[model samples]
Target: MASSRGGGSQQVIRTGDMEKMSLDQLKAVKEQADIEVNLLQDSLNNIRAATGRLENASAALHDLSLRPQGKKMLVPLTASLYVPGTLDDADKVLVDVGTGYFVEKTMAEGKDYCERKINLLKSNFDQLIEVASKKKTLADEAGLILQAKLKQSSPSS
Candidate 1:
């Protein structure tokens, strides 16, 4: 077996000719690799869950935006001002309960939910970034240790 050297340099290692590594060195390398892999997996899972919530929130917002807002009402109430095309079909008119209210309550609720989802996604992203940084540091350290071991095992040229 063969492996490339650190920093994408020209050096290479031929494992077959290398002397056997000590038990402690092997165990240390294994532990470092395991930590990096576990952190990466956790980051992946967090991003996946955050993305799902974002997609759901975005879909709800889109659906709300497409709702029809111009339709005449069959039953006219004196207190409410009926705005034509408020409902999806011709049967329902948009009714304003006295005070020039243009707010879509459902849409408002959806926006709130979307905001919350976005905050959660941002938090997850930050966590993933932190984890990724730690993984990189550990991986770099492991690579250095492994390279040192390989050099020690190699015949002095």
Candidate 2:
């Protein structure tokens, strides 16, 4: 098969010649496909985690915006510590804009920001899933081709 290369380069590999190739060449194609699938899977996993976080953040922002001002609540200073505090101004909140940067925003504004972030993350997750699916299909196809070549070379029918 002819494959296009970068910089106007062209590579011509005849699939008919697979039977003539050494065992190593067939194995190499399978190995390369496996690596591609693995890398894409890792990227998909990370995107999934980010998507979950954005979903949770958006939900929390929405819930916080519904509370009354000066409502008594336990503020979480850490994952395990919840200090007694009150919502001095339910209409105001601190939002992390990313990269360790934060800004004060009204509760409504914060909810909007979280929603936007969630939408962007969802889009990214969809794109990543598509790519990962394609990579996995490629890997499976390569493995099948390799198996066929091996059977063709074997003495047994």
Candidate 3:
């Protein structure tokens, strides 16, 4: 496999020749593999969090649709701050579509938006999981190779 390096240089390491590599080279490969694995895991975690938030929004939409119009409730203005208000139009709701943008949509449409976003995020999460699994396997193999090289270079007890 060819490992990409800075300055557009690539280091190619054949699987059959791992034992022939120097200790420093093996260590570098192991470190790079570990870093890639960590980054992939972080991406997977972010996708999971986004999916959870969308699911919660969908549930809140369902609950809101059940309430009658003109019902008095506490409307949140900021964290730990809410003002007493009455529901003016429950059927029409504002949806935050991200990047400081909000769009008005019917309650049913808002719920559908949330569901679609959840499905998209879930699909991305599944694809990322497969990539992460392969990276983890590569990292494990590099670690084992590095250990073997270290033992060969060290003095025996």
Q: Highest TM-score, which number?
A: 3
- Please, what are the lDDT tens digits per residue for candidate 1 over residues 29-113? 5475566556566666766776676676567456546655563433334437534334554222232223776434455565665
lDDT of 3 by residue, 1-157 (tens): 1121121354544555666767787777778777877777788888888888899889988988888999998877765999999998899989999998999999989999999999988887787777667667766777888887778879999
- How would you encode candidate 2's per-residue C-alpha lDDT over 23-83 as one tens digit per residue? 7886775576567556756766776787687678778777877888888989977669999
Deviation in angstroms for 139 in model 3?
A: 0.7
Superposition error at 64 for model 3 (Å): 0.4
Q: Which is better, 1 or 2, measured by TM-score? A: 2
Clashes of each: 8, 1, 0
Runs of candidate 1 exceeding 4 Å displacement: 1-23, 38-42, 45-49, 52-56, 69-105
Cα-based RMSD of the predictions, in order?
Answer: 14.8, 5.7, 4.5
Q: Best to worst by lDDT, what's the order?
A: 3, 2, 1
Model 2 scores a TM of 0.77
TM-scores for every predicted model: 0.48, 0.77, 0.85
Scored by lDDT, model 2 comes in at 0.68
Which ten contiguous residues of candidate 3 have the minimum total lDDT? 1-10
